[model samples]
Every structure is written in C-alpha cells, then in structure tokens.
Target chain A: MAVHHKILGVATLLYLLVFFIHVLYFSLKKERVLAVAWMIIYATICVHTLGIVLRWIESYRMGVGHVPLANFYESLIFFAWSVTFILVVMRKKISYPVITMCASLASLFLMGYASISPSVEKNIQPLIPALQSNWLHVHVVTCFIAYAAFVISFICGSLYFVEWKGVIPPKAVLEDINYRSVIVGFYMLSAGILTGAVWAHYAWGSYWSWDPKETWSLITWIIYALFLHARMVRGWREKRIALISIIGFISVVFTYFGVNFILSGLHSYAT
Target chain B: MTLCTLRRLLSFVKEKKTIRLPDEDRLSRMDFHSYVPGKGLGETVGILTKHYRLAVNGEQGAVLERGKLSRYGVFIIHTSIIVILAGSFTGLLFGYRGFVTLKVGETKDRLTLRGKTAAEIPLGFALTCKDFRVNFYPTGEPKDYVSTVEIIENGKVVLGKEIRVNDPLSYKGIRFYQSNYGSAPVFFFNVGGEKIILTEREVFRKNDLLMMVARFEGKVHDFGPGVLVAYLDNGEPKAAWFLKSVDRLREQKLQGVKVSLVDIQEQPYTGLEVSRDPGVFIVWAGFALMLLGLYVNFFLQHRRIYLLRVSEGLLVAGMASRNREDFKKEFEKLTEEINGRTS
Candidate 1:
C-alpha cells in the first residue's frame, strides 16, 4: 500500500486555494462567499484526515513498523493537520474567520514545503533504536499535538496584534479568545517538554544534555514563561502579550525544524 | 678483643644485607607513609576544631535565629535550590552508561564504558550478545538495528532478549540497547606448529591470555606477550621475530625468539549501548512534579467568584481573576435566570 502522496498533495493544494478564497471573501465583505469558504474548509479537513491515515497505512506496508514521525517532513504534515483540526473545532465557539485564514495559510505552507522541497523526503522510514519504543507514539504525538495547538494560538495572537495596532479593525472578543488559546498552548507545550525529557532519560540515560534541541526547547519554554509572568504579574494587557506569544511560537519553529537542519546534535533524525 | 670483633662482624653483616644489588633483590623498599602524611591529620583537626568550637560557643549564639530570616523568602530560595540540586545530583551519581558491539552469532562479555576513564561494568551480572541484525527502509534509509542478548550470572543464562534502541532488554536492573555498527580487525595464531589462520569466523575473548604450545622440528622455544604465553616444544626455525606495523611488517630476531605474523581480517558487527540508572525514578519524579506545577500554574487559573447581598434583596457579583469578560457574561445570564424565576 504505497502512500498516495500525490492525492494528499492535491487535496492540500485545493484547501490552500479555498483558504485564499476565504481571505478574498472576507476582505470583500461578502458574507455568503465567506460561508461557502467555511464549508469548503471543513471538506478539506476531512480530506486531510484521510491523507494522514493513508500515509500511516503506507508506513506499515513499507515495514517501518513505526508511526510516520521519524523525520521533519512527516512531522510538518502532522503539525499542519493538527492545527487545522483545532481551528475547525474552535470556529464553532468563536467567530474569527480571519484567524482561521492565518492558520490555514500556515498549514498550506507546510504542505507546500513537504510537496515541493527536495530535502524533505516523504517516504516511510524504519524506526531507529532510539525510536523503537511505545513512548515514541505517545511522546511524538503529544508533542506535535501541543505544537499544533501552539501554532493555532500563534495565529490568533498574530491576529490580535494586528487588530490592537489598528492594522485591522478592533476585535476584542477575538483578543480574549486569543489569550485563552495561548494559555492552553502553553500548558500543552509544558506537557510536551516534560514528556520528551522523560523519554530522553530512558532512551539516552541522561535527562538533559544541553543538546541544541533541548536548549532551544528550554529557550522556547522561557519565552512563554516571560509571557505568562507579564500577563499574570505585570498586568500587561492583551496586545503586547499576544505579540510575545507569536514570538514564542517562532522560537518553537526554530526549536523544532531550524535546530535539526542548521545545527548538529543528538536529534539529527528529527531533520 | 674477641667480643669487640664479634660486634663489628654483626654490624658488617647488617650493612651488607642492606646494600643488595637491584637484580639480586627485585623489590624496592621506601617509606610509603610519607606520601600522604598531613591529609589524615588535617581531617582530624577539622573535625576536632568544629566540635570544640560548637561546644565553646553554644547553640544560641552559633545557630542563626528564626526571627532573623523571613520564612517566605527562605522557602522560595531554599526550595528551588534543593529541587535543582536534588535533580542534578541524583541524575549524576546513580546514572550508569556504556556500549557493546557484537557480530551475528557472537557473544561479548564487556561493554565499552561511557563517560568514565576506566572500564567498569556497573551491573551485577554479565551480558552476552547472541545475535545482531539490521533492516533498511524502502527509501534506502537505514532503519532499525537489533541485538539479541543473554543475561549471564555464574555461567548460567538467566534471561535472553532482543534489545533495540527504544526497546531495551532489561534484566537484573540493567538495560542493553542496540546503538551502533562497525568492523574491526582480528588476528590468527599458528600454535603447536599447526597452521591455523584466525579469520573473521574466530571469536577472541577480550583480555583472554591463551597459551600457544608449538613444536617445530627439534628446538623448543618459549615466547609470550603479557599473559599470552606461547611455548614451542621443538623449534630450530632460526628464531625470527616480526611486529605488525601499519604499512609493512617489521621483522627482528631478539634472543632467539621466532614469531611470524599472518593475516588481519575485518569483522563487521553491531554495537549496543547498556545502562543501569538507579536515579531514573528520581528524575522521573522531578518530571512529574514539573508537569504538575505547570498544569496547576497555567491551566487552573486562580478564579475567585464573589457574591454580596446589597440594597433590598439584590445580589452584586464579581470575579477576582481570569476570563473576566466571560465571567461578566455568565454573571449577566445568571441574573437574568434568577429574575425570570422570581417574577
């Protein structure tokens, strides 16, 4: 069962087009077209789910006997899917079409990179000795899930910043939602780091070796720590904190992908 | 005069015994105690001085008073330091790590110790590799490597299991992990004048001293390096010695000892990482505490909802923290529900 990467690729591209349409409709103030765009986004989400499941099956056939998270490309696809999943669920309670648009754009970028980039090979690889444990499933899935949640919060935070600076119309309702998302994201990120650390201790015999991945992750944690402190203690309002949250997410990106490609460390397989 | 001569003879005998030749007496006599004289004395003085000082100065003046230090301030600093120190120290002291490499159908007794200057097996029992295998992905990227290992104690195989990277073989409080792969050179020996080429098929026990007894023609020769002693019962082979060099084999004859070097074969095998960490549970506990602290700190916002009765059966409500806008909306909805019921 070969992974239908081409099918997934096409479906992702179609979703990207739909996301752009949503943006165009919102900018044009066309309510009917915006509703249509939302429906298309939902359909695209189902397709994305199918693509992920298909890739997982293909991995089994390829005899990796592991999840499709052995490398950066698979992780990027997972991240994009997770973000879209959260955004769709969030859209039910919050009426923030613009934030959704940003998330979709991020997801599209991940898919586009996976599909187009030569360095990112979209094939099922066998699990290395370090990744042959059951913890791989639990740890990698949880970490990426948390990462996806952060990405969503990052999008919302970016939107809040734009509205606060009057780049876009003020949406105070979305600002509170954005803060809530960040709080949730921060909690998940903490969980992700803790899980990864525990797993590392078991696999490598050392809990923290100050590897590039671990260091950057701690840096990411500290950034969110500063955001939390500013919000809870300093009584700083939403706009500045939201901007900081976005900055934190960028660090998360560097920690996850940049550290793997640009820097050499124990987590070379992650690249 | 006879008694004086006898005393002189005894003194002369004592001096002769003391001034023995190096080859005749192989041992050296020196004052070993001079190496570390002041160390023991310093420790003794340190303990005695502290004890006497404590006795002289009393607890009242020597110990810090509770009133002098703020409780909250002390708690914050001390607790954080204790947590960090406990985590680091526990991780360092009780952590044992090493690596082992073995080819298919081969067994290894010692694992390469990591982060240590000397070779030491941290585990109580010995581990022997039984088999090693590697599988590749369809994309041609090398995938999994596994090593089958047996836990041995007193020549008895207690447990047999295959250990991979994430999936380790745990026995007797130790784990073996399949980590690396490489090829090494193996040498052959021709003992007892019988031609035997030691190839990749031969397994040499690490640090094992084998006695190679050989007979060549009529002369007998005995040669050895360290514990590996070789005795030729009959050898008149004109005693030629050869040293295996990097580029070319150097031949020399030293004291009529003949040694011939043969082939060097590369043996490919897999490497396994072994570890036994008693501090892992403590590190895991720390992780649990950290996660719990984060969850409580972030997710469970300190929300305080207050309701006050004022002005003829009217209720005023307020929240102290978190999602105030949502709280306000909920409070309004609750008021509306109450009003509807009352009316």
Candidate 2:
C-alpha cells in the first residue's frame, strides 16, 4: 500500500521495455514473428492492466474508494494503459511493429516521467467535495482514451514523414490510419469535454467557466475539427494532413498535462 | 428476372418520390459507368437533379444510388451543435444562481445572488431551516452535512425535505442545495430565573453581577462539551469550568452561585444555494441529440452509385463515404450484385 503506485509504475515500464524489444527485433528484419510479438503485446497489456486495477483497489482500500484518476500521477499510468490497449487492438489489423514501438515509447516516457516526478502526488488521497461524482470516472477515462488515440495517430503521422516505406507503414496507410484515429479521438475528447462541463455545472453552478483546462480542451477540440475539415479539402495533401495530425496530438498532450502543471483552476486537484 | 421481383421493385419505386429515369430501352446504349453528352433530355435532367436530397436512389434503369448519409450526416452534426448553442444561450439569459445562510430555527425569504457584489433577491416564499446536522467519517473527514428545510407558502408548509451535498430540494420553480455548514458555540444558563444564551466571549449583566462565557471546550475530560464562565464583582472575576448541559455548578462552580446549566448549544448554520434554470432540460436534450448525431455521423458509412446509358452496355461508377478505401470493396461487391441480377 505504501508504494502501490511505485509497483504499478515499474510494472508499466517493464511492460513497455519488453514490448519495445519485440518491436525492435521485428521491424528491422523481414522476420514475421508477429504471432509471438502479438502474444507478447497482449501479455504486457494484461500486466499493465493488472497494475492499474491494483492501483484502483489500493485506493479503495485506502478508504478513498475513488478511481485512481484524480491526479497527474494516476493519469499518467492510465495514459500508458490506454496507449498499450490501443496498440494491441490495432496490431491485429495493421502489420507494423514500428507503430507499436512508437506507442510503447510514448507510454514508456509517460510512465517513467510519472514515476520519477517528485511534484506529482502518488498517494491515494480522498476525493474532494467537487470531485465526488460519477463524472470523474467518465471524464477521465474518456479523456485518456482520446489522448491515447491521438498518441497513436501522432506516431503514425510522425513515421509517415520520417520513414515512409522502409520499416514503418507506407505513406497512404499511415495517412489513412492517422485520419481514422483522429476521428475516434475527436469523438472521445468531445464526450470528455461535455461530461466535464456537466460535472462542473453540478459542482460549481457554471458549466463553462473558461478555466484553463476547459479552454485548453476547447482548443484541442477545435484543432482536431480543423484537421478533419482539412482532410475533406481537395487541396490539403497527404503531408499537410499528416502535419495537422501531429499538431493536433501535440495540442492534445498540452491540454492533458500542461494545463495541470501551468494553470490553476477548479481542476487543480488534477495536479 | 422473375415477374414477381419486377413487380415488387416497380411498386417500391412508385411509392418513392417519382423521378423520370433514362429509359431501360434507351436509343442505342445502356451503360452503368460511362456518361454520354446526353444526346437526349432525360440524361441531362437526371444529372442535374442528383443533388436534390440525401438518400439512395434506385431506378428501373438499374441505377442504384447511396451515400445519402454522407451529406446529411455532417448537416445533422452541425445542426445539433447549433441546438446545443441555443440551449446554452437560453440558460445564460434566464438562469439565476444565489445562496442563503440559515441558522437553526431561522426563516429566510431572500437569497443573496452569487457575484462579486452580494445582491439580496426575494424568493417569493419563505424557507425555514428546521435543523442541520453533520456526520463525520471514521477518518475524521465529513461524510455528509444535511439540512432539513421547510418551504412555507402563505404561512402553510407546502414542502419539507432533507437536502444533502449531492441531493437537493426543489419546490415550485427553484432548487435549494445543502452547500455548506458551520457551527458556533453558545452557553445556555439560568441567571436569576431568566434563561439567557450567551455565545463564546459574550457577556450579559443580570442584577449588576456581570457574567460571561470567556472560553469554550469542545470536550473536557471526555464528559462532553464544557465552557469556562467568568463572573465579575467589582472587576474581581471568578472563573469556573461549567458544563452547560450537565448539573456541574456544585462540582466546579463558585459556591452560593445561582447560575446553573440550562443547555449548551452548537448552533449550526446551513448554507443553501438556490438556483433556477429553465434551460437545463433543453440543454440536456441538446446533449442527447448531439451524442446521437455524432454516433450517426461516425458509425454510418454511405455509398453511391452512378449508371450511364451507353451504346455498349450499362457502365457503373461507385463512390464511398469519407473517401475510405474499405468502402470501395463494398461498392465493388454491390456492383457485382447488380451485374449478376441485371445481365
């Protein structure tokens, strides 16, 4: 209980590190060990999922009985879980280990940063008055899923530019995947924003207070909307659309983490 | 094709919005994909009227169209957004939020509007705080603070209910939420046959013998709440630890004193937030509609088909929604089905 987060954090990293090894082993050479890698990916996902559930159980045992998604430390673990989940689900359809590597790398960084950060509170704190709602689960889960989706699209878009056909997927496939992931991310993040607004209205008597978190979420939403619109335009080429995808994911990252660290609002508990 | 199938298809077409299609026996050509310059008038009209609506169109000429959702889906999403915006604006224009603080046994009819400057507004009906209580968890964190309130209209008790943090009481047009609570220690004493309640540090003079509750102990010796009373005679004060609810005057009080325990009360003041928003229901409706619309827009894929009446045969062209390639395979299958049936 004293270091439940520490254990989960290390578990996430170990999962990421092991998955990354498979990604490296398969991507460079023409060896189709995807079955082995596929099984390994699910195994890592199970371990990562176990870690998250353990954290949740620990919070409940701590008498908080709330989801372990109230702060930055917990959200980072969730972010890693989401990314790995997406990776495993996507692996069956897209024949690319590079995407897994990219996703795992991002998860690795998030989990590592969360585990090493001295500022983030790792303890299972009781839910504050404003945070005691079912909406906490809905908003945080949906938001992290959106973030996870965007992270996948960001990897696809980045690889579309850096290495078009050698190890990563081709330009057309990556572009298609990027657009599709953005579509999913857009819907999820929109749901998250609406649920957060409703929760805010219930707790604080106002729905949209233009708080830093709200503003940044709106910004991220607008950017993705623009990306979708640009995708429809005949003039916007593949590279331009890919660039927008990356930009949108960057904005998503900022909205997820930067707002908590840099701005103060009713959502300050997320810090 | 069989006569029964032809009749069913024809009947279906007749029930739909009628439009003249290029004749199946058109002059020299029947194509599904190639477009002629419309040496005839029907071809021009068919091409010109393609954009009238958002639904599939199939004709006797074997032209099957789809992707109606492709265009209308975006419109639904956009219109739902407008609806949500309208609902929000309605809330902003008509909604009012305010709060009132009520102590036990106090009645209030006015609320202070929540803003930078406090403005008192009448609630048109009186609200009485019958009682307020706080429950704490084993960890010392507050579990709940509940207020039992009564709504009085024309001196008649119309409604009475307990309101907690997440649960609110609604009457007529407004809602009252138990937002907060606070307690203040007070000492109850009988002095010279006249009972008086003195708050902490408050002094009351009875028969020129000044008496005051100088301090309070929330708990003393685990026997429950006790207070220190200061009695002054010519500026020379006598202090005693008095449990206002217990008969402790003889045990810890000054000898020959007439003062005795009446009761010690921790008067609880409940903070109630009053809100009335006519647009909340509309806003929720809009949210539901938007969610439904987004689901339709994303989950439903549309496909369209074009048929060209050419000299060689019927040439067919296909289109998929969102420019996704996976739909092209579906379109190919549809085209193959039409070819197998018509040819």
lDDT of each: 0.60, 0.72
lDDT for A105 (candidate 1): 87
Per-residue lDDT for B144-204 in model 1, tens only? 6767778788889998887766666777666776668876654455333334444333422
- Work out how many backbone clashes candidate 1 has: 6
lDDT, model 2:
0.72
TM-score of 2: 0.74
- Taking every candidate in turn, the Cα RMSD to the unseen true structure, in Å, is 23.8, 10.0
Residue B65 accuracy (lDDT) in model 1: 15
TM, chain A, every candidate: 0.91, 0.92
> Tens-digit lDDT track for model 2 on B1-343?
1443355456656756753345534522432233333233344325434532323344324334554544455555666676778878887788788999888888999999988988998999999999998776567777677899999999999999988765678777688877778877666787756788777777787655787888888777777778788887567888878774465442343334477767777787899888887777777777776666666777666654555555554555545566556666664555555444433
Taking the candidates in order, what DockQ does each have?
0.31, 0.22
* Residue pairs in candidate 1 whose N, alpha carbon or C atoms collide under 3 angstroms: A129-B165, A129-B166, B192-B214, B216-B234, B219-B234, B219-B235
- At residue A93, candidate 1 shows an lDDT of 48
Worst 10 residues of 1 chain A by lDDT: A161-170
Q: How far in Å is the alpha carbon of A136 misplaced in model 1? A: 2.7
